[model samples]
Target: MSAQFIEKYRENAEIYTGSDICKQKSKELLLEINMPNGLLPMDDIEEVGYNRSTGFVWLTQKKPIQHRFTKIGKQVSYDTHVTAFVENRKMKKLHGVKAKEILIWITLNEICIDDPSSGKITFGTPTGISRIYPISAFEVEEDEKK
Candidate 1:
């Protein structure tokens, strides 16, 4: 399959591979979308919040570029408004519970893929998992804004 097709059907193929590959690919794709010049500055991302319950670090773009991921003969759409707001509010509520740092999660309510060649369709439902994380999780460098 072509790189385009691979990228288009990556989520489905993820089950066959480890999450490391998916993380690397996701980073590459997101970098391409936000950093066309190949310069991905750390400041381009902002620290939203953290989820102590899940121990995930959440980060959001300092600027809203194109959030959609696309490929020839394929389409991907995501809605972050509801999840983003809910997570942010929940983060605020956690301030008094435990000072444990947390990262907000962006949940994709729905993911639909249309394959023209095979004339097939695939849909993924959100398991309430996050798509991105703050660099802090790796202890590389803490999110500047956080």
Candidate 2:
């Protein structure tokens, strides 16, 4: 049957025929969201730390930019935030930057970072896992700063 009675039962029709596996729900979808803090190997993270209990590398979330940019009036515009974890303080010291500088560095490098010297953004993240949210979403946490 061609499912002419589907509307009566509120069923829908979507046709995609390529692989039979595509029609099946992912087994991974049922798995728990237990993403742990660990450095993505390709991230080229420096200053590795040791934890006797667990072998997990400490990692931080980084937003990746996946759009284009342009000049608006006299200011530059961007569409994404690139973020990630720095392995340790030594990485910062080696880069000659303090804690505050690191955060600013992320924003600065949101587009393309090309500083050849120490102040350049040295580390990289897994690329696609960076958090990309609207600035208004930060409102709830902003109140805590004051």
Candidate 3:
């Protein structure tokens, strides 16, 4: 993220540094917001920040990475910096994330579980395109320390 962007949101935000802490914090935030913990799967996270009052969250990593959700057969790319405004069951105004659709990469702007009971989750794009998939498709097993 740009220095100005970080400065504007860093005030009063809960910030955590280090890969381990950042990874844990990211998973915790996702669970708190009713999203799947495996949705991110970012590697080597350097920092994580969350501003409760504004519902803004940001994550910084050493480098960009692309991960494939094997269960769902989809590939998604995450940038070095990712930011979003999160709320219960929803994340909006997201930046720095994209999902590959066939041969094209679609920028994802929103993700929400409209009704938990429906067992569905929706991924939306800025251009009004969206796809709903079974929530189980994104569920992942937590890492077990060896």
Candidate 4:
């Protein structure tokens, strides 16, 4: 219903990242960061190089690129250098802030994998596996402006 609520109920809601209110609030700050040369990076780092695909922008490298069928047999291209610049100054404002701490940051954690039939398997999910982004991650680089 509101920003705080949206940030709570829908941490990953499109409305949170792409809302009219969010646009107005984060525009100025968001526009200062560098967008990747072609597309946004798909890896975890301090600032998440995430871009909006359809709904709510997920700020994790864990996101997947979309693909479609073509003469080449379901081919897709992701340059990571062509990430779109947030031209709408209004939308640029919603860039930086500490995403609410979800599951406190632990140095390490165990990841469990369970097959529909099997019992379970445990693997170590390493640190830096995920990152919460700063607002500056979306800005355009100064050297990039030619």
Candidate 5:
């Protein structure tokens, strides 16, 4: 059932990139990134994009996007973007000071496998594969007007 919710990326014609997948571990990863220490309940997530040429996959949540008030009373929400992994916490250093607490930047590490025939996706089974970093923020101007 979970597999039905995932988006498929076709590599050639017969093989799917298998970037977006619906699995327990993938859900947990999204939940951990969304909330640290499991403080907030995990919401459903769906994959956004997969670059078959570069082997990159982007993720997003299925739940309603939440917005917050700015210091100037304007309502805005964070736009998340995942970048390549760096060991020295590059993302945190660059954005840690400006990013909000709810906005988390994390270096994701995992080996994903795609089943061309069955359309099943699999990731490495290790707890520490994904790590959380600081949150990055960019206000949506359109949202602020609404």
Candidate 6:
């Protein structure tokens, strides 16, 4: 995200820097919002910021990354900077994230779980197209040692 954008929401935002803290904070934010912590598997995180009042969150990493969710046989690419407006079980206006379709990469703009009991999550694109997948596909198992 641009410095100007960050500055606009800096006030009253919970900001964390460094890889360890950023990673932990990001996961915690996801869990708090009723989303899968593993939805974002970026490493070398440089910063993370959350504005609770506006439900805005941003994360920055050392470099862009492409991760394949083996269980779902899908590949997702995350840019160095990602931003979104998140609320309980939903993330909207997402930026810097893309998913590989059969032969093309589609930008994902929204993700949500309308009903947790459905055990399904929906990913939508800017074109109004969407796909549903089992929520378990995005969950990350906690380390037993932790």
Give Cα-based local distance difference scores for all models.
0.25, 0.20, 0.92, 0.28, 0.28, 0.92
Candidate 3 segments whose C-alpha is farther than 4 A from its true place: 1-3, 143-146
In model 6, which range of ten residues has the least summed lDDT?
Answer: 1-10
TM-score of 3: 0.95
| Per-residue lDDT of model 6, residues 57-107, tens digit only | 999888899999998999999998899999999999999899999999999
Local lDDT at 87 for model 2: 29
lDDT of 2 by residue, 3-100 (tens): 22222322232222222222121111111111111111112222222221221122111222222111111121122111212222111111111111
Q: Which stretches of candidate 2 lie over 4 Å from their true place?
A: 1-33, 36-103, 106-146
38-87: candidate 3 lDDT, tens digit per residue: 88899799999999999999999999999998878999999998999999
- Report each candidate's C-alpha RMSD, comma-separated, in the order given: 18.2, 19.6, 1.4, 17.1, 15.6, 1.2
How far in Å is the alpha carbon of 64 misplaced in model 2? 15
The per-prediction tally of clashing pairs is 4, 6, 0, 22, 3, 0
Point out the worst 10-residue segment of candidate 3 by lDDT. 137-146
Local accuracy of candidate 5 as per-residue lDDT tens digits, 32-121: 333222111223444433333443333345443334434333232223322222111121111111122345523223322232244222
Count of backbone collisions in candidate 4: 22
| Of candidates 3 and 1, the better by lDDT | 3
TM-score of each: 0.23, 0.14, 0.95, 0.17, 0.24, 0.95
TM-score, structure 2 vs. true: 0.14
Candidate 1, TM-score vs. the true structure?
A: 0.23
Query: Where does candidate 4 stray beyond 4 Å?
Result: 1-6, 9-37, 45-56, 61-91, 96-146
Task: Supply candidate 4's per-residue lDDT for 94.
Answer: 26
